[model samples]
Target: MHTPKADYPLSEIRRFLEPGPIVLVGSAWKGRRNVMAMGWHMMLGFSPALFACYIWEGNHSYEMLRRSRECTINLPTVSMMDQVAGIGNCSGRSLDKFETFGLSTSAGGHVDAPLIDDCPANFECRLVDERQIPEYGLFIWEVVKAHVRPDPELPTTMHYLGRGEFMTSGAIVSRRDEFRPGNL
Candidate 1:
């Protein structure tokens, strides 16, 4: 009934517990725009559409996001693996990522950041809290506007496995009948 376990390093913990898909973050400031791949974000609430993410200070987009106070979070599907890896491996300070990766973009309704035209979903966010930035490199944002591609409602998403690896989304399972009514 039980399997034996062995010691594991804490640094590799994210390889097992990484949350959510790798998203491309779009940010614009002072007439400049850039897109960077991000994997450290998570949803915090539903009512106001709150979410949180960590962006290191060394990242070029960090200052842009801090100053602009807005950005677009774009979700890519499994087919976009090349673009995802390329975007994350390169720096925005050198070249136009959208052009380099052959990605296209469009303007969002509520933010100055550009939304990836290729993504199935995009969220325009506004920074709601800056308290954690200096100490934690964390940003709290409220998604002000959201857009979705109507077709293919359930697109397979990619998750980071760390050490240059990934795990793709798989089949769905439902237990609605087994859940408490209030919990739903």
Candidate 2:
């Protein structure tokens, strides 16, 4: 039997996804961590090193992150499009996502979290403060240590919006080489 699939305009979807190319954030509690595909995250500060990620309290990853007060922000490249979608679709409570999805991870030292393998970059963080808004349960954490892959030719970041939508970052085709005169 053949059935027609509902379709929506691509422009409408792009309108909702405001930000672009966001790093994926993951958290763990006792070797059981969940990956949250998010677009609502940003760097708060530099010296003190603070980062904020907005997540719904009801989400499995949010609860785990809140309780543990730590997370590993893993930045995946364009190649991991499928893996990102897989993690986002399922919940850790029902499935051992890492094992089922064939995702690999390493134990973090400073934070009791698992570092997502195959990601281009990863940051180990600890929760500094949390602001709860009924609108969207938001959490802010501080980055403690960062890990970069040995390979330097990795692609730019990848991000996901609501639904099963995602987009990989494009290259900086045109940009000023330097801002300061002697910076180069």
Candidate 3:
């Protein structure tokens, strides 16, 4: 028999409909760089490699990102959960996150931001639209360059469940055969 569903709190809906994996957003402006943990990002398109992420105005990196108009999106794996948590729980206003966390970085090819060297994948992005920033803190971007480590085809990533909890990505289950060519 199918299980019965219970009404859930609207605020806690993220635990069920999480967007994507938690990522470390790298931003820099005028000689300063910062890393912020973010989970509210998603793939918005494919042709121009467009992406969107929300950043509250109060965030330390918000001003830098707005002025720099570029950033590097670093995808951290499950192994870096502790570091990810540390990055998220602290503010980048007072200290250098890279030095505090011992995160090594490399300069991005297209953007002025630093890419976390430990991350398996890093995407250089340029701000494309900011019309939603006033109404919503959304920043649209176009990925200009991307680099990935090839050893692990699929790396396990963390998904935030709210309330200081997280879920790790599990085994892959593909249904390629069930989808039409255009849909796949």
Candidate 2 C-alpha lDDT tens digits along 34-91: 7766668766665466777788776788778888989987776777778777776677
lDDT of 1 by residue, 1-184 (tens): 2122223232322222234889999999999999999999877776577789999899899999999999998888889998999999998998989889999788877899998877877788899999999999999988777776655655688999899998998877889999999655
Count clashing residue pairs per candidate.
0, 0, 0
Clashing pairs in 3: none
Tens digit of per-residue lDDT, candidate 3, span 2-23: 1222222323222222348888
RMSD of 1: 10.9
Ranking by lDDT: 1, 3, 2
Instruction: Point out where model 1 deviates above 4 Å.
Output: 1-19
lDDT at 104, model 2: 81
Q: Mark the regions of model 3 whose C-alpha exceeds 4 Å error after superposition.
A: 1-19
lDDT of each: 0.82, 0.67, 0.81
Candidate 3 steric clashes? 0
| TM agreement with the true structure for every prediction | 0.88, 0.77, 0.89
